[model samples]
Every structure is written in C-alpha cells, then in structure tokens.
Target: MALVETATFECGGCGTCAPSTWIDYDRLLYPVCPEYGRATGPLA
Candidate 1:
C-alpha cells in the first residue's frame, strides 16, 4: 500500500488551497496529483 503523506496549506479562510487544490476542512481530505496517481513504482 502507498504510504500517504499530508500537505500543509496557506488558506484564505476558504475551503480550499489554490493550485495544489488541497481542500480546507475541519478534517482534511488529501487530493493526489494526477501525475502522482499515474506514477507506477513505490507509490503505485
């Protein structure tokens, strides 16, 4: 299984992190990059 890591963000008190597209929530949900998902090695 992929060992997922968390991302930190600079938010505008909004429910999102721009560019990275990571959501701002009371509890976080990680958004994997499309390229990262396509990678088929250790993280696959």
Candidate 2:
C-alpha cells in the first residue's frame, strides 16, 4: 500500500483571500498573503 497525505491552506488575513493554485508549495505557505505574496503568518 502507498501512503497518501493531504494538507490545507488557511489565509492568515480575511477569509476572502484566495491564493493561486499554480504556485502552491510547502515553504510558500507560511508568511505569504493568500491574495498577494507578502511576508506575514502562522500558516501551519
């Protein structure tokens, strides 16, 4: 059997933020604004 893991992203700002699916990555999740690329967060 193969192990499959999944994760989700929550926008640190308002719930209205939506990030681009194309740029989705592990490191980019933190300190990034969902609507715009910026440093700020607790993305875990």
Give the lowest summed-lDDT range of ten residues in model 2: 16-25
Candidate lDDT scores, in order, read: 0.37, 0.50
Looking at model 2, residue 44 earns an lDDT score of: 49
**Candidate 2 lDDT over residue span 1-44, tens digit each:** 99965544455564434444423445654445545655456544
Q: Name the best candidate (by TM-score).
A: 2
lDDT of 1 by residue, 1-44 (tens): 99976665434333333354443222234343343232222322
Cα RMSD for candidates in order: 14.5, 6.3
- The TM-score measured for candidate 2 stands at 0.31
Residues forming the 10-long window of minimal summed lDDT in candidate 1: 35-44
**Candidate 2 clash pair list:** none
